[model samples]
Target: MTRKIIAMAATVICVLGGFTASASSVAQDNPTVKEVKLRAEFYQNELDLLLDKARRGNFADFYQDVVKFAHYGEKYPQYLLGVMLLKGDGVQQDIGQGLVWIRLALEQKNTEWQKVYDSITAKLTKEQLDALEPMYETYKARFGVQAQKMSCNNEKMEASNIRIHQCRKTLVLKEFYSVYEYN
Candidate 1:
């Protein structure tokens, strides 16, 4: 279970795109190490919550919650919504709109999100790209992090001795981490 959690945490950090330090830069006393540690703690809190809820098994409710959180400017949810839109899973199929959500989600770039963005964009024709450009620009202006004035804060969890970081665009709320989450 601990190994599973660490692997999941590593993936979350990669997608979160919060670290740029190379392996050589990580050390026992380095700031990068501290940052990574804090991020792990934050993601672990998310994982614990999400894993528990997922065990209850109501995907429709889960999908709705993801949509809500995406609109709320949480990065991971935005990425999930993008994939959901593209796949027409629990929502209408709309590749163009899906790509838009994904582009917005990549505010903090990582190879994982970049690969998804590139794969989708590569499949688009000139006309499709042209058509989607305006919509993407509009969504970027409206829902982008700068537009939302979204900012993250590290708050101590009342139930535990650790702190969790949450980003708020407008209203603040609690939010998740786990491999089972992706599954």
Candidate 2:
């Protein structure tokens, strides 16, 4: 699981190579960037645990963790929370809310998520469809990428003493890795 996350990080680093920074630069006195990295690491760790629990079929615990992660503007957890809500896995079934969560995740522009979004929306009832707009607006305002300030725009990642440029170039070259490989 940890390996999978690392591989995913590596892949994202590759795709976001333009955002890479020198280790020395990242180690400088930029408190805001430092804070963002710290928060990202903390959330990533929590997300790893949550994913592990989901893999173990601990839906109840997974649901609780997903709620927290989704609130923190994590896309994958928001998608999972939506699935849970749609099926009432650990909470009451709420189609509208479920769609909203999936919509939020899809807004991040992940193609895989789009498949899920399309399939679900294709079968929605009239009331469910009606509820989507307002709910989507509300969740979007609070959990959307822009609101969360999620951007790959020159964000620094920890690479110890290694030059981020070389490291990212290598990782990006091998695009076969999937974060969901283990799952």
lDDT of 1: 0.54
TM-score of each: 0.52, 0.58
What is the lDDT for 163 in model 1? 68
Model 2 deviation from native, Cα RMSD in Å? 16.6
Tens digits of per-residue lDDT for model 2 on 84-153?
Answer: 7656677875555766788888755666667766755555446546646765765666556655545422
- Taken over the whole model, the C-alpha lDDT of each candidate is 0.54, 0.55
Per TM-score, the best of the predicted structures is: 2
- Per-prediction RMSD in angstroms? 16.3, 16.6
Where does candidate 1 clash, by residue pair?
46-176, 46-177, 47-177
Least well predicted 10-residue stretch by lDDT in candidate 2: 164-173
Q: Please, what's the RMSD in Å of model 1?
A: 16.3
Q: Report lDDT (Cα) of residue 56, candidate 1.
A: 68
Instruction: Look at candidate 2 and tell me the lDDT of residue 55.
Output: 78
Pairs of residues at least 3 apart in sequence or in different chains that clash in candidate 2? none
